[model samples]
Target: MRSCKDYSAKIPNVKPALCEAAQLQDSKARSVLGRPIWSRDVQAQGAPLRVLVLGGIHGDEMSSSSLVFHWIALAQTPPSDTPVPISWRFIPTLNPDGMFAKPARRVNARGVDLNRNFPTPNWARDARHYWEERTRRDPRRWPGTQPLSEPESRFLLEQIDNFKPNLIVSVHAPYGVLDFDGPSVPPSRLGRLYLDQVGIFPGSLGNYGGIHKGVPVVTIELPSASRTPQEAEMRQMWMDLLRWTTERLGSSASTTPASPDLPKSP
Candidate 1:
């Protein structure tokens, strides 16, 4: 359970950029709303093992955003001669309009759930009904009128295309489990916490990237959205994630066969 204080030298003071609408607001709201924070490191050789980590796609999941910010702060310092050569891109909050809403909405300013707005093959056919049945037509889970309809979702897709991440870790909250999609590899301590693999939805990043595009997408569901992790828990989770990443990408261990029965997008 190491603290960021222990690696203070490695942490950089990176700032955030405001989204288009946020920039139009008065100074206070502009600073807080519709802002996206990112940290990038591309100092590796050849085509570096690109990794993208995102948080706060569902804006109500505030803890996920906090965890990502914490990780970004700690990862700012360049790694020293690490076995894994990687280029990291961290996005702390993608749906800032929802996250900064007075009561923190699950959907963005347009009332669309960014998570269900990716342009997956089944988006047109399955997103709306699946959301309706799953949450009893909850507004919180409403898919957009069409895939990639919202700016937030489109922005995420743009990053995926530009960065071409080898692995993506999207953090969510209050689910207390780890759900993974794509190729199979040795399970890690993080996966052990939530071994029950959840089914993928039509336009979920898991379905679009992992299932369809053959990329690994690991969704880390935090224990609670209402509360940030205690120091010890935060450190433990960070260590486990780092270990999993290094083992999966840096070593030959990642060559383990893909699961023949991996869930397919509906």
Candidate 2:
């Protein structure tokens, strides 16, 4: 519970009780500064569909992590309507060092952007070129000396292999749009955010997981970095995501009701 309290304090819209209810487990993977990267795996009865939800890749987008916590609570209840039995793996804070930094940095302690440090196709060439030429060598978006150079990136790559999720949902912030990759029909909207289909970048998770690995990646760029949507709005986004997932991947079943633990809007 101490870890829950500590983590919840860093992000807006999340209280200690919310994180405690999430019951996050330490992955035993250490960050650049030796901070523990925590995760929670929720399994439904013989769940045929496996989905991975990741947040805090940039660390500064704390709201993304907040949303993951809320969803963890939402996922606890098996809605009678939706028959989509889901195996869920939630990584709430993938970049703890960056997230816990005094000012909440976008990059890790080593100054590498974990989001841009994945091993995409031609990463050696394209990653460097994109960093140097396209980004004008932006320090915040640095791809690192090599792909998977950071332990944080390596840990994620390991999850993609070990977990072998059918869909990967990566949450980010301050962009206010939804982006999807792979063969599935993308969700048109989640809450107020609409699909934008942003182009992929070198060594990006969307490119590595969604394009190269053939796994569907639903990237949610929330509207704000510091503040999350209201509880009703967040639940609406979760419901939309649930509906979309069942429609696209699960058995053509009914939609789910709200998590019983979650309070209704006033």
Candidate 3:
């Protein structure tokens, strides 16, 4: 039974983690909440494809939180080279206030669910006004007075604008569903691979992303807040995702022009 004030205290100050991930002397970027947010650059020489991995959108979704943290750990020593093929930008935890303060609180310091707070086209017309109709005893839905009202939501919006990733993955929990969304259809293999890994029904992040922007977004749902799956299950899902991404990248790379040194001779 955490009160709003109590929950506000739990939001982890992401500054420390963000700095560590970007390996920046100091984080120059800031989230909409005014917390420090950082970006690490892994540039590719040619038209490098960009991907954004956002986790912890829901405060209580521990598996998603763990996954993003794992990714940040990897980024600390990411392969260093120009034209690295893929540039990954991670927002390890979006709702720091919700995460640290109210591990139980799904919403922010203001009691707004960052996910539902997104600026959907019909936001105003949304009758439920999620906050007023919260489902949980210690629930997360409450869209604030308006959409994009909370800082965390705004922070994500900024990331979308600056990074413009070709793909976005938003992780959530308890349903074990892998939702694929975007303006265009997802690769058929993706749907099957996700089903094989997480073992839940498929879902769509692009339903909202599509209305706002045409980019594809996928939501990877985990089992639940309290029940963390076995490591083997988690590993299998990630491996599948990696395999899919790798195959896609390989196809893209093959279409590229011949190397500089050999091309001149021709």
Candidate 4:
């Protein structure tokens, strides 16, 4: 329930223009830990919707991270027209500390992959160690020396509690695949969107498709390296998502469906 103003003050070096736009919105967005989560709102006018977009869960996936940051930058200006009854909260560059320093790591400075850090009953033992190797023990995927240990991971956990988004998207890259988690999202529509926009095969996030049930989380992987890509592809991904949101899933409001029984660890 934190206001945009509150978040603006919390994140240092937030663009001044963005701060101005946040002031125009009536409601605010908060981070998981009660600090401000980066966000912007244009009144539904009469109808309201909530959408959350996450970037930089993996430090090496800068291609995806850049697009999300671009969206945040856009949110600084009030939309020339009222956007579809949507309240958008964009968490760009979630692990800024890691991203600024490392190119392709998925872990935070403490070396934990935020994606793998989510509490699941069946996470493979030493699963976090895989990330450690990926980063060459760069301290990016060390699993924080414990669970839910990094600020970025904790921030996202809190965002889920506070924003309660109808749809959440996490961007990643180079795999040429789109993976989804959560139970409520229709598999047909979710896969179609990825195949249509990026020509990537579709799959489920870590095969635990029902971890959070109703809160469908779409993970889009771009064809870019951790740092480079054709500007066109990057822009297209953004436009496709915007179009998908405004046209396809924009109005679909889903709650967190009950977590389903996850498969055994691989």
Per-prediction RMSD in angstroms?
Answer: 9.6, 5.8, 8.9, 9.3
Ranking of all predicted structures according to TM-score, beginning with the best and ending with the worst: 2, 1, 3, 4
Please, what is the whole-model Cα lDDT of each candidate in the order they appear?
0.66, 0.88, 0.54, 0.51
TM-score of each: 0.76, 0.93, 0.67, 0.61
Best by TM-score: 2
lDDT of 1 at 66: 69
Q: Return the clash pairs for model 1, or none.
A: 10-77
How many backbone collisions does model 2 have? 0
Stretches of candidate 1 off by over 4 Å are: 1-47, 77-81, 251-266
| Per-residue lDDT over 49-130 for candidate 3, one digit per residue giving the tens place of the 0 to 100 score | 5667887777676567656545555544544442335556666567655666533557667776677777666676662343
Please provide, for model 2 over 52-159, each residue's C-alpha lDDT reduced to its tens digit, 9 standing for 90 to 100.
Answer: 999999989999999999999999975779757887889999998988899999999999999899989999989989889999999999999999999999999988
What lDDT tens digits, residue by residue, belong to model 1 across residues 1-266?
A: 12222112121221232121111112111212345333333234442366788888887887786676666544554346456655566666677778767778888888888888888886787898887787788888888899988767777777787667778989888888888888857244462355457888878888888888888898888888867676567666766766677777656433332222111111
- The true-versus-predicted C-alpha distance at residue 11 of model 4, in Å, is 18
Clashing residue pairs in candidate 2 are none
Tens-digit lDDT track for model 4 on 145-242? 45455666665666666666666787777676666655544333332235333311111223322353356666776665345344465545555555
How far does residue 245 in candidate 1 sit from its true spot (Å)? 1.9
Instruction: Return the top candidate by lDDT.
Output: 2
Q: Summing lDDT over every window of 10 consecutive residues in candidate 3, give the lowest-scoring window.
A: 257-266
